[model samples]
Target chain A: MYRYDEFDQAFVAERVTQFRDQVARRLAGELNEEQFKPLRLQNGVYLQLHAYMLRVAIPYGTLSAHQMRKLAHIARTYDKGYGHFTTRQNIQFNWPRLDDVPAILEELAEVEMHAIQTSGNCIRNVTADHFAGVAADEAADPRPYAEILRQWSSLHPEFLFLPRKFKIAVTGAAHDRAAIQFHDIGYEVKRNEAGELGFAVYIGGGQGRTPMVAKKIRDFLPEEDLLAYSEAILRVYNLHGRRDNKYKARIKILVFETGADVLKEEIEAEFTKIRASALRLPADEIRRIEAYFAPPAYAIALPGEAALAAARQADPGFDRWVASNVTGHRAAGHSIVTISLKPIGAPPGDATADQMDAVADIAARYSHDEIRVSHEQNLVLPHVATADLRSVFDALVTAGLATANAGLITDIIACPGLDYCALATARSIPVAQRISERFAETARQADIGDVKIKISGCINACGHHHAGHIGILGLEKKGEEVYQITLGGSGDETASIGDIVGRGFASDDIVDAVETIVDTYLERREGADESFLAAYRRLGATPFKKALYGAA
Target chain B: MANETARLWKDGGFRPNPWQDWPEDGALEPLDPGTDALVPLERFVADPDVFLARKGRLGVRVAAGEDVAVLAEHLENIALIALEFPSFADGRNYSAARLLRERLGYDGEIRAVGDVLSDQIALMRRCGIDAFLVTHGPTRAALQGGRIPEVRHYYQPVSGPEIEIPAGSRPWARQPAA
Candidate 1:
């Protein structure tokens, strides 16, 4: 939760007025289609297949109760009674009129939000661990760095219009919840021999028409030289990255074209020139920025704070939610409460207006009014007291938000496919809903263990299928929605893209296809605690493919 | 986007019945000349000697030997400094325009010619572009060009060297572009 300073506030406010004028001119017939196309896009107002979709940046998936309520208000007043929370930790309203966008932007600015750089070729909303300051295992909060990048990249003169959209995600944990390895630019917070915190930088990792695990360029980039080093990378890409064909435009294509070694050499040379200059982060500024994301005050210790054990002994319903949704906290008396959006039949990342309000109220009451939108398409009450876990679970159940599928089999990261998105080739929600139905039994889900089932409607990989433990890609085959499953992908410190297990399954067979893989894992897994990814690595896709395809 | 209201207008464009004295809007307004067409920057033939001496060069300047630091050389003389916006995203011209006026301080007919859009008029002025040359069409035609890229711009720069009536401010004319 970084609050806007005068500079940040002024910058966003001015951008809103700028967009308002641009919209006025367009409506007045002062600008034509060709001239206005790029303008609209840069502001995150897209002319989709159906209507204009404005994507509001929820920077790194963090939101205060105020911001959430504002989004809910926007949904009620300007759009259909809902908003689609995207995988990048942003929100998209599907049916905004072209002319009303500036007004929409004006309203968003009131909440310290604007749509700048949300859709442009510039550095996008810098994503970080959604559990940044809350997770018990976190080495350091990643939001300070994310916020720093946000301020520097907003309307960055040189890199605004790049060859294609750029994405960066950061994580401080040894376990990668942020999916850093799958982004265009990924940063893993690591400590060197001297115990200095810096980033292990990865470049060219992305999923689109071509998927790649970003190759590491810097073993450790000193924290201070982040901007200079990033500029060096983007400058290199801008000068050399392809623009001839849209498909080959991403930095991944360059990595593929000029091998990682050559690219790394070029970046290092470029970094040397800028690192010794003004772009370097001074210690004071870094500390000032870091202070915005300081952890909430928590009691050092709670005697017998095994609230989970107490709740489990008292109530079965609370026990199920606690077992699945409650996770480790950085503070002794606090726990990370994940509010699952994936109900039995609803879309994975959608929130109805009322549900949004309820979550906001819950966050305000039980969790310091701070809310986090996970890349997994779930909301997180990041710093809830461990003692209040059961009460929060109770409120969630009443609101129909309690699904007990945080990291379990049914906890799916889904993209808005053909149903709402213009880029989708098939329906991802239906596929996710079907799989969730197959694993609806609480006991069955608990027994199956933590398996990330990510479904992407198309190659954009918004659902993060590449990092899912079991990635399901919904594609069109001869005009029918077919699902292709991949095994063993991970999004942590040891991240890897899931390998295709076998041929795709038809829409009807997708659920059975998932069940088939799970059955294989159960039979071959060495023990109960070894998760799906561990088993897949131990056994590989060959065993799973055989299990699904049979003999052949 | 609104087609119904568009058909009601005659040539000069949609005025209700009692319109005032204006051209019937037949021939489109020709664009102002480009640097190559104008005689200044286009005149310096590979060197700055002749242009500096004010010899017979009646053309616009790419850069006369009058180094920005040697401002004493050309104080009274009028010149034009045109910022080339190769593309909208390239902000080099933005800084270049600001320095030419506020810092190194060139007092001349500052012009933003290439790829100039009407919406940027206010900004171009603040940064010092006094005149403009629309590359493709007449100014009126350029006005109808699709969506304006930004609803708001952080800086003040105009599309051309024109005195902008800031949205709600009183109409007070400051020193014009040159």
Candidate 2:
């Protein structure tokens, strides 16, 4: 929703030209593969197993219908007619040729989008709550700040070659939909007792080979010091973070090794020096950015409850969908609808070009012209009038986007693993597919209630397996693919890393292993009111471990 | 001795390199008077006053892993500080350069040396490196051709005062002087 000003336009156009030249140099052999890798990565191009993958940043997961349609066009024209929305709320085209990538970037630039900082060892695309401005519980919209950070981190001169990749996530609500605690830097926009706005800053939380929950470095940082504080943190990390071991190079490891107290002191010292510098965001600039994300106009009154209830009662299918896919909005008489990308058996986040176009058309007509991509690998219609729910549902059903599995067991989050990823050690999509098929029965899913099954092909944790209630990590052990399961991990406000429960499961047996864990939760839950995560916390891993690994 | 592709780029174009690198292992004694020798930071810090009081102009070359804090105290006397890249991908010096310019307010020449490439030239300049000792062939050619690829508009301000911050625009948006 943030429009590109003249400065923004010039910046992206220049970047496109720069990247195009770099690509030409690479193709001409003026730059070797090793030399060109980081450059290409910074532009969000990765040479995958079969071909190049182009990841386009959907800043803060916000998209205009026009932008969404452009994405659909890129998918149709360049890539295999579909795009995989990643866990970070960005979209990846698995089969874009190197030659076509600059063109794709050109197209993105025209739509106020570019893939800058989507990858490589730099501050990555800033993510926020998918239900940013629309959520009923949010204190403030996090997207404006996300946009500000996006601008600051783009082609940042000092931080471009960090020891390891960094990710920052922000949330403005008490319930952490953006999973802020599992990021290198996490911010929760909050109002103090005196009603002054600021942030609760969390540092160093990430899930890779070594999963870590971020430490709260500051209880309150004033909104004006946002960029300054972030600069301080990054400066400290850049100067002191480990470069010897790539695996231990994330800011989390720095926090872990230096101890949070010491790291906090160092960061605070740096903050004290630069706090009054130019990086301190002026109040006017903050307000200027905030204005762009102000809420859309809604009708003064809309009679929707009766109509929605009638439609639900008339069609059980519609009722099920409304129950699962729809959520309450901050504005009265409006609802936030999640268009599920996770179908019964297909890849978790892949959406066809047609589905994308349909979503764009639907958003343009029913909701405001805005669309959102949730980190759970689903698309969101953030401001649909409640009266239009039935029409939205019907359109979604026709487009095959009306899957009533928003938070159900079948709503899995998985990465494009060994199938397309060069970093993957095992196949993750197949495991997710098998589990989705096992839990395909809507009745069974309803009985199970809110459960998240996440799978990653390798320890890199691209699948976010460490944050799932039922986490499965696929590993190559002795030339055989095995899945290691973890229990009780969560990415919400109550964030914790899942624990590995005994030995790994063979690919053929992973689905049954997942089913066993689900069955154990169902049997042991206090009541239907207790979700899988709550039940796991109460019961601990002993019961789930026992169920999976037997009495031993 | 410098790499074969190393060219002295300062101000806006390549010029003869006046400063010669003083090897870390080489003895500090017996250097010619007024010889512009860039010694390693470790050697310079071993005896800061010795280098500061030397007849020749003082320049210190800092490795990517070395601390730049030591140079803060002697900034007024130092003529040049060469920050090493080790490789183009190692960016520790960028932070070091910013610290020198913004934190320590060092106005002396800040040069980027070692593995310098065409793509990184613009970034080095923004981080307050006023000069470059480029060792990549294509980078030298690009510099010679005045074809350094760059996005002149910046969203964040670095230390230098020459950068223009247009009024009424977003405070963060900056453009380098034409």
Candidate 3:
């Protein structure tokens, strides 16, 4: 909910003009594709398989209703009337002409948004917990710190071109909704014994061909030293990270190759020299940034428990939605409502223009004119009143945005695999669609309980299949699409990479194969109270492997 | 032996490059008076006393992987440090240039030597590389014409003076006056 000041405004506006010139130069044949590639990528334009996909950054996954409307407008005018929200909490327009990019950027700038650093080997969009300020268990709102990082990393002079793309995620809550462990650098907001705020810094975490849970480089980095410390980490990685092999270019590999202790020593040495510099954030600046993220004004009203129960009694559909979608808020009578974008048989995160507009309208009317995009490919109304939940749900129904499957089995996270991606070896969207259709019944999904089915078309793991409770990785085997299943992965506070179960199944049998695994879990669960993840933890992968591959 | 238009942009303007590239493979020799020879760091480290005895201005060339820390003690004596970008995609030199300016406070010409393209000119300049040894014809023309598209406002405080937000002006909310 941070508004861009004049400096930030001018910074984005000038970048748009600069990119406009670059686009013009490329169009006029003054610059070839090889030269123009990095320029276009830094501005979030990608040459995909079918068309050029333009990804727009939604910083810290927060947006105003006006901004959402502008996104809808852009989707309607420039793209194919739809936008896919990516796992990084950003949105992608799959179809946009090269000439229209500048125009699109201009429009985005008007709404305090741009596609800068959405792609390319640079510091990418800094993500944080979607429920930053609103979550009950939050230690602090990580948005201000994330924004500070966004400012520091945007077109950072030395880090413009890194060994590979760098990702940073911050989580302020006890629960890691931002998937901090899977990022290049993860910051967890913490308070020291003396009650002074700082960060628990984790470095080298990433998931691609190689998956790694970030290693804790610093137990507690004082909040004042955030930028300086980050600069040190980047400086170390920039100078030493492998450039010869693109696959081994991430900071994770560097930490693996050089060992964390040596990397820490180098970073500490760099930090010691630069910590006292101007990059040390002034106390006033921290306070100034924090002021922007102050909680929205709420009326001191009675809790909506009675009314919510009454409404749930009246409509079973609304009851199901409330059960799955609604989350507790710090303020009374207010609730965090997740608008599930993962509808049955649709692309995991695709929202049509009408759906976007409707959500925008609902956010303005029911919520406090604010919207949040979750890393799990869902939109969040962070401050919806529990009293207005039914109204919000009704509007969502009108736009077909209400799926009522927030953490349910059908709430899948998938990548834009062979459908639109040039890196994909197999199709991912169709696989997600098949699974969703098979478990379309609300009762069945509710019965199965919280099981995340993440799919990626290749080893890139853009779909975050490594963190799914039921991860499905699609690989091309001798020109055939084969689906490999992994069990018991999670992206929460206790993050772990899932283990692959035996041999992969053919694409035709993958859905049935997944069903057998789910059925096995249902039969073997310690009652319905235990979720799939909990059950898997208790029973381990042996049973699941046996269910999938027929008893070894 | 480069042409006149093939000049280095130093201290905010174009100036003729005085130093010639060190021979790729040859015997090391003493430099001519008043001339600068850009020698590789490895070659310089092999015999530091020999390079030190030269009468001409001294410049050290660093490859992408070489440590910039080795030049800390020699900062005052070195007139220029030319960092190589084997390809435009390899950005290790950017960090090296920044370390020279900010960390070591080396107040000499830090030139970006090889594979320097037009798009990267502004970023390299921001990282405190004051000079460029550009070989691309159009890139050189663009540098001479001052046609490099650049954004004046920056969010981060790097090697340059940051746009100061006046005290008590709510730095986060204060809009720039038109």
How many clashes does each candidate structure show, in the order listed? 44, 0, 0
Winner by TM-score: 2
Q: Write the per-residue lDDT of candidate 1 for residues A86-134, one digit (tens) a residue.
A: 7888988988888788888888888888887789677888898989988
**C-alpha lDDT of all candidate models, in order:** 0.74, 0.91, 0.89
What tens-digit string does per-residue lDDT give for candidate 2 at A1-552? 799988889899999999999999899998899889988999999888998889999989999999999999999999989999989989999999998999999999999999998889999999999999999899899999999999989989999999999999999999999999999999999999889889999999999999999999999999999999999999999999999999999999999999999999999999999898778888888998899999899986888999898889999888888888999998889999999999988999999999999999999998899999999999999989999999999999999999999999999999889998889999999888889999888878888989988999999999999999989999999999999999889999999999888899999999988888889888998999999999999998899888888897
- Cα lDDT over the full model 3: 0.89
Q: List the residue pairs that clash in candidate 3.
A: none
True contacts kept of each: 0.11, 0.74, 0.75
Give the poorly placed runs of model 2, Cα more than 4 Å off: B1-6, B23-30
Where does candidate 2 chain A have its weakest 10-residue lDDT segment?
A276-285
lDDT ranking from best to worst? 2, 3, 1
Tens-digit per-residue lDDT, B58-128, candidate 2: 89999997888888888888999999988887889999998898888899999888788788888888888
After the best TM-score superposition of candidate 2, give how far the Cα of residue A377 lies from its true spot, in angstroms.
0.4
Q: Higher TM-score: candidate 1 or 2?
A: 2
Error of 1 at A47 (Å): 2.0
Q: Rank the candidates by TM-score, best first.
A: 2, 3, 1
Clashes of 1: 44
- For every model shown, what is its TM-score relative to the native structure? 0.81, 0.98, 0.96
